[model samples]
Target: MLETVRRQRRAAALPYPQMTLAVPVAIEGAALHSGKTVRMTLRPADADHGIVFRRIDLEGGRDVTDIRVRHDRVVETTMSTVVGNAAGARVGTIEHLMAALSGLRVDNVLIEIDGDEVPVLDGSAEVFVDRIEATGLTALDAPRRAIRILKPVVVEDGAKRAALLPGDGFSLAFEIDFDNPVIGRQAIEADLYDPCFADDILRARTFGFLKDQEALRAAGLGQGASLENAIVIDGENILNEDGLRYEDEFVRHKLLDAVGDLSLSGLPLLGRYEGVRSGHAMNNRVLCALMADETAWEVVDFVEASRPAYAAEREMLAISAD
Candidate 1:
């Protein structure tokens, strides 16, 4: 009877299994805001571990401090996403790495770091994706679960707006409008499960205006920003000599950011997300709104092995929010 039950769990009707790194992987770089050299490692975890960050440097490395990467743990969204524990141990600028893991569908991992902020390698998700793919992923026996939107949930802040609407699978549409002529109005829409994330989105580097450099640095931010890690805009021209990886990289980076920020929902989201000039704060807000309204979303298995792979993708593009 036990053997039969085990066989039933592996049947084709079950959803995809949770996943983590096949082997421990390490990467080192300069922290984006602190300018401190930092080392981070990704370690495989048990089935339901979910993504967690451990601050090894806290308390002089004598104690184990952990900060769960979840929407509710978010303590700040000034310019980046940050999560904190009850003890006030915090991790900042996790969106890029989160995007890499989420895009690759890694559900369980323990991220160990020796700093308050994540490294800003090339200011894109490329380095994270490369390292994760090189180490590969291992699937756990537990079936993956996702948050399915049951109704439209929207949040607005001045001109910024973000919404999650009922849909099949996960999809995102983002629009960015900046006064800078080099990065004016731009828009992007794609299925989060498509190859476009790795092929197009991950390479788009974070950007900032040269005029804001002084102000940002004065506020103890962007201390490690440079031409190598971020795109610096001066007037109508980009300061980076190599130019952009994509003509519309500005908006693409926003989409990449949304992917990471939304991943904090604690589970992969099976719905359509639309954002207009929204940033990290609005992303968190929309999620909070959805969770607050119990009728708006439900937890479920988003994919089924027995059905065609594209079944979820089919209904993604049909849903829209005006």
Candidate 2:
């Protein structure tokens, strides 16, 4: 019985599986911030060929710029992290793509876009995950390399802040306080190590304060936004017929964004994150801070994920949860 138990335990540790987006998929939808209609396609990339965005609408009518999920190419950390190239052909509102790829642990992909923003389908990573699943995933012959946070790295903007601290697995604890009654003072602590974005966080749509909707529209934004795609909140009301995906969904959504944004590091970070009213700017700041400091992290040679795991490194985020 003792030997049997030992074998079972070892087998249980066999390793987490590997998956990839099945094939190139074209997606059309609206952007979260700009609310513009976008048409894009997903193409598979070779191993170590991290997530890259190509603006097909550019002058050359090709992928002139490929913004990688690394620290150096980060151009803007505003309403969202905007990564651009020397020619400035950029893809906006990338948090959703980043979230889906990072949350689902997809390492290599090339996202070609015709519009300026990524499609905000369903307002969360669910649609992207679903599309990916529909496209199908297959294992590759490469070992995965994951980033393990060795210590705490914190960044602040006024009272807004975000912090990453060493932990056994990746997690996020967030707190948000809004004056609006519909979503006021919400907090969430999520364990990404267990990796349940498909249920707990993926379906939670993006939200906005009603008072700002018209103002945003007036500014040439939110043109395609509706209750169908986002949470419309008044002082004390939910504009949507449905209430919410979670009781404290706002904070969970924020944490989801953080997970996606931090993934820009081109590595699956193993850490616990805590934030309060921090947005893309602060999030990128924290990542830049970590990159600037050598003590914050070290390059991993290999991730011992599962049974048929590869030996050499180069595959990104292979050991995401395990």
Candidate 3:
């Protein structure tokens, strides 16, 4: 049974046809930093359109922002991923939605938003995933492309670090340590293409220390934050009445953020990503570094299991055949 499942997962992880939503989906919620209610519509796009954001409320939708999902467009990463264009138009707190798109392998989308930031619906990707799934996905005629790591790339800031190495399929390992006893240290590793993503990673709410709430608010951030949208840790206790979604929810959420950050590369990645106490900034830095050295990565249309270009392919095949 285990071997059969591994084979099925490997087959599913193979390069697939480009896909887009079958129909438009709409969502409305409060923006995390601004605390303002906003409406967003996820619309399907043709092949190679990638993911785009249009500020419909500005100039009657003339202000459209193409989300390159790259480091150059990332204007801010202090609290959440913010992408901006040269015209000064920006969309903040996009990671959760991006993660949902990546997890479902939605290749091209046009996100129409009436606000500067995405709504922090439940402070997790769950709501976004639910709506997108409800709309369903349709595969395009074009083949999908993946960014295959040819060599290792690493970035570090103090004790925080993020890296990517050649691998067959997308996988991530993340570790986070917080002084608060409620979190402490936790780590997790999983293949991004696995079914576990929707069940495990998508629902883990973003968390913060109760002590930092006031400071964050003073900094004009987390204005929409409440016990309803996020997990709040006060000392050794959890302030949320329902408690955590997972035993190591903190680290799982970190991995969720990483998935969203890495998806900014515009192409699905075929590599192993490892992060240690890393956040949005570090994740973007590693991606930038990888892209800077063109020799470190290549764009491929398909994964050839026989050639075994990546180390993880051999391991995956071995597990599948066992």
Candidate 4:
């Protein structure tokens, strides 16, 4: 019996195989912060390769630099997520693409770019999700792994906070309160395990306040921000002619950001995440806190899943060395 099982494992017949893109996809647009035109391509990768960003524009593509998408590689969280290597090769605003990959369960991909930031197409993950879906996905010959929260891990900054708690499957709840009357207070909750719900999250666009435009420009940010890419609020009303995508779009966008930020873990997460007015910094901080305490989390394989009382499928989380 042991020999039979060993043979099966060696044959790469795993219960849950990792996934990668079936074909290469490309896109070109203006980066949100830099306001510079850039092009990016997503290519298929081998199993266990993880998601990596390759800077092909560096030194005029003479020597390409690869940066793995992982939490420890995160170097900045100022209005956007930025990952860098020791040599200061950095890529910013990766949260949207990251979220799309996480939702699609794409385990391995090679993202080649000719820019410092991923193009903020409509300030949402919809473009990325659509392109990837059209290209399709293929299963690899390796088992999938996820970080299972064994205990509650929390981080807070004054009134803002984020937490990851033990759960059978992935889910998120977020609440945000803006001073502007147009936004005011809003909250959203979703079972990310559901593909349809995740798709909705991907469509939620990032928002900004028109009042802060000058200040943001002075600080060298939001250089490419415009009504076409983001929902701009002007205190009492939304500046966009088309108006809101969802009634609670403000909060939904926050939840969308959390999905992308938490994906820095470099694997799918099996747990519940709750955030209260949290931003990029707090999201990264919460992840750091979860990883700091060794007893809080464990790597587990997807053996199977069961239909729970909730609408989403509850994964049966476990791992075995054999």
**Residue 5 displacement in candidate 1 (angstroms):** 22
lDDT of 3 by residue, 178-277 (tens): 8777888899987777656777898889998889999999999999999999999888899999999899988999999999999999999988999999
Winner on TM-score between 2 and 3 is 3
Please count the clashing residue pairs in each candidate, in the order shown: 0, 2, 1, 0
Q: Estimate the lDDT of model 1.
A: 0.85
Pairs that collide in candidate 4 are: none
Stretches off by above 4 angstroms in model 2 are 1-19, 33-35, 61-63, 301-322
Question: CA shift at 60, candidate 3, in angstroms?
Answer: 7.4
Supply candidate 4's per-residue lDDT for 308: 61
* Regions more than 4 Å wrong, model 1: 1-14, 60-64, 304-322
Model 4, span 74-120: residue lDDT tens: 99999999998766788999998998888777889999999899999
* Residue pairs with backbone atoms closer than 3 Å in model 2 (clashes): 15-305, 15-306
lDDT by residue for model 2 (1-322), tens: 2222223323444433333566887899878767667899988877777788887767663446566666667787655677877777777778877887776667778888887788877777888878876666544456556777788999887789889887655778888887776777988877664435567876677888788888887877777778877888887888889788888878778887888888888877766788999888888888888878889887663333322221222132334325
Q: How well does each candidate superpose onto the true structure, as a TM-score?
A: 0.90, 0.85, 0.89, 0.90
Every candidate's lDDT: 0.85, 0.72, 0.85, 0.84
Model 2, TM vs. native: 0.85
Ranking by lDDT: 1, 3, 4, 2
